[model samples]
Target: MKLTVVGGGSTYTPELVDGFARLRDTLPIEELVLVDPAADRLELVGGLARRIFARQGHTGRIVTTSDLDAGVDGADAVLLQLRVGGQAAREKDETWPLECGCIGQETTGAGGLAKALRTVPVVLDIAERVRRANPRAWIIDFTNPVGIVTRALLRAGHRAVGLCNVAIGFQRKFAALLDTAPAEVHLAHVGLNHLTWETGVRLGGPDGADVLPALLAEHGEAIAADVRLPRPLLESLGVVPSYYLRYYYAHDEVVRELRTKPSRAAEVAAMERELLAMYGDPALDEKPALLAKRGGAFYSEAAVDLAAALLGGGGSPYQVVNTLNRGTLPFLPDDAVIEVQAAVGPDGPVPLPVPALDPLFSGLIANVTAYEDLALDAALRGGRDRVFRALLAHPLIGQYAYADALTDRLVAHNREHLAWA
Candidate 1:
């Protein structure tokens, strides 16, 4: 099978290449294309990708190009990981929102909405190109604001499934804690992308016994620390919230923390510089250890699994992915895209039935789903009012004063990216 990675110039590409090399038997890729507009970074990342494959003794041909259409043409699958405005835009996304006393984040709050607006149109255009180049190809989106992007793709009738490393990272962590293999653990990952909770941790398979209580009893403090949440909250709620929830559960505190620290974008920019330097080293074949500090942990495994399953390679039967709710959660609209456990195959992900959600989680999920709907509308049809409405709908920035201020700042900082502005 052939696979193309749009935005393959990203520093994260090496991690993905490493996974593709190690999991070659699972996916068996014959041709791999790395598409990026930034020619310099593409050369650096592409060279490292080739070396990684060579070092691993994998014979797949690795190709690099600035041409999107040529990169995607006739490929079996296209993976989207592009950042529309790069780290500079992300720095603005992470910093400006803090001025409004909201947590500064790339995929949540007003910052997330800004990213959604900038990203959705670009992703759709790329998807359209991919569809035209190879109609049967599956689109696996690893881009931020994944739920919104994936929904846009599906709504446009593209064969697509959104991939996130959160579930796989959690699975690996829970397995290590439980002293089991990663495949032996399955998470009842529920809620929208980034905003999700591990409601159940089953072993063996989907129907396996739930070990979440045991996990909490054993690793509650550590898990809470990892997510920056209080251990008592996990015990009280009987579920583990994704780290993104910190922006909600402790909004003011997070805002204060964000204000004190340099934006994550700044730190990542520095890290990318170092990573690219490392990629330039001809002797460096394996993925550098520093890449782990750059997020998207276990992304390679998740991408390989999702792609293999989608391309008719028999791999894991069930995996966590972002797809249409289709009533998996009775509270969410069927069209709402949600991150959850599902049975994976060439037919696409069929979201498994989730047990009844507690009002606590369900309420937040519903609220965010509504906000995402407005966010998508604003993304597709640009206007200040649509932007204002989406910001106001967000639980983190519900106040009129903050929403108004954020809307103005978002539009101002992103005017170049927003055509209507």
Candidate 2:
């Protein structure tokens, strides 16, 4: 089977490439294709791919191309990780939302919404190409705002699945924080993309679901103690979820117990600047070589594992992913993309019946969906009016200002992002 990586030059590409190459025997991929609009990035990833194959002694052809159609031809799976307008554009995606004063973190808040608006069209185009070139291929999207983009692709009628490292990574981290292995945990994750709450986590083995709440209550203090570490979802749910908890739980109940101070957003910015410099430096040939050498340990292996389980006749049950709400989330609008359990196979994704959200969780779900609709409208029409309306309608935003004042602030602060599309 052939696999194509849409954004071959991303910093994470070598890791993913190396991961798949290392797992060649299990995944059974016979060829690799790297696609990118940037020639330099294509060469960088292409070179890395060659080195990875050489080390593994695999004989598959490693093809790199700027031609999307050529790269996607006959592909079995396509993984997309593109930054459509690049970092400057991403900066705008984030910064403009923050300028408007709503919780503007990319991936969960207004910033991510802005990104979805601008990125959907590009992803759709890629999906269109994949459909035309390889009708049976599954598109694996690892792009930011994955929830939104995955929905967009599905709406456009493409075979696609959205993958996020945060959820499982959080599950693993929470299990570790509770001094147990990941397999020992049974998690019930719900809600929109990044804003999800686990709602339930139980011991994985014979004891069943009853043991979880007591365990969480018992470990809540210990879990709360690590609050500043990022990935607040697990912590909020009673274990420290992942490295991103600090950002999500900054305003949560036990945040005061955090052992460390959350780093400023500027720190995230600095890291981006460093990555930008690395990408722009002309003397980076040696860098790619070093990266290639460590490629065998790349993070995409988990995804490969999931793929193998689903396709290698392992008969792993269908898993939850992002999809239109419809009946799955009764309180949410039918059009929203919700992450929940579903079956997976050549027939494609099908959502299972998701239980109704408890009142508080349902309200939170509504708030998140309201923002998503706002971002979707903003992105589709390139207008801030819907964006502002979204904020005003948000639980958080509504708590802070009157509708008139909210619109005025949104207009005053987001003048740059709100211009005509």
Candidate 3:
């Protein structure tokens, strides 16, 4: 099978390449294309990708290109990891919302809205191009604001599914704690992307006995540390929240912490520079240890599994993916994109049944789903009013003054990205 990575120039690409190399049995790729408009970075990453594949004795041919249509042409799958405005755009997304006294995250709040606006149109264009090249090719989105982007793709009627590393990361960590294989630890992962909870941890399969309580009883503090939430909070909720939830559960504190530190984008920018320098080394054949610090833990594994499943190469039947909810969650709109465990196959992902949720988690899921609706609205049909409404709707920026100000800051910082502005 052939696979193409749209943002193959990203520093994150090497990790993905490493996974593809390591998991050859699951996804046997004959041709791997790395497509990026940034020619220089693409070559650097592409060279490292080939070396990583070679180091593992995988013979898949690696190709690099600046052309999108050509890169995806005749491919079995197209994976998107692009950043429209690069780290500079992300820095703005990470900084402006903080000025509004709100969380400056890339996937939620005002920052997330700005990212959604900038990303949605670009991703749609790529999806259309991929569809034109190969209508059967599946588009696997690893982009930020994945729910909005994946929903946009589905709305446009593209063959697509969204992938995130959060679930896989949790699976690996939880499995290690449980002293079992990662695949054996099935999470009752629910809610929208980034705003999810593990209601249960079953073994073997979805129907396996739930061992969440025992796991929590023994490793509550460690799990809490990983999520950056207090141990007491985990015990109180009886579930483990994704780290992103920290932004919502403690918005003010997160804003304060963000204000004191350099934006994550800034740190990533520095890391990218070093990573690029390292990539230039011809002798470097493996993903560096420092890349782990760059984040997206287990991203490669997740991508491999999703690609394998979608291409019929073979993968775990059940996976955590972002897809149309249909009616899995009684409260969410049928069209809303939710991140949860699903039965994946060559056709696509069909979300498994989600048990009734607590009002606490369900209420937040409903609220964010509403915000995402507005976020997608502004992204599809840009206007200051629409942007303002999305910010206003976000639980983290509910106050009118903050929403109004954040809208202005978002527009001002992202005017070049927004055609309507």
| Number of the predicted model whose lDDT against the real structure is largest | 1
As a TM-score, model 1 comes out at 0.99
Candidate achieving higher lDDT, 1 or 2:
1
Global CA lDDT computed for model 3: 0.93
Question: Candidate 3: lDDT of 242?
Answer: 96
| Poorest stretch of ten by lDDT in candidate 2 | 254-263
Clashes of each: 0, 8, 0
Q: What is the C-alpha lDDT of each candidate?
A: 0.94, 0.63, 0.93
- Give Cα distance to truth, residue 191, candidate 1, Å: 0.5
What's the true lDDT of residue 268 in model 2?
45
Q: What is the TM-score of each candidate against the true structure?
A: 0.99, 0.77, 0.99
Over the stretch 36-118, how does candidate 1's per-residue lDDT look in tens digits?
A: 99999999999999999999999999999999999999999999999999999999999998887887899999899999999
Ranking by lDDT: 1, 3, 2
1-421 in candidate 2: lDDT tens per residue?
Answer: 7888898866667567666767777677788888888897677557756776776777788898999999999988888988765655555444444433444455654455556755777788889999998787888888878777877777777877776655565556667767887666656666776656655666763234634466555766554454444334444544333333344445342223322333234444455445445545544432344443322232475567556554543323445466677777877777788876556666655666655666756777777677767766666566556666665665545643544454454354435444463
| Candidate 3 Cα errors over 4 Å, as ranges | none
lDDT of 3 by residue, 1-421 (tens): 8999999999999999999999999999999999999999999999999999999999999999998889999999999999989999999988888876888888888889999999999999899899999999999999999999999999999999999999999999999998999989999999888999999999999999999999889999899999999999999999999999999888889889999999999999999999999999999999999999999999999999999988888899999999999999989899999999999998899999999999999999999999999999999999999999998899998989999899889999999999999
- Winner on TM-score between 1 and 2 is 1
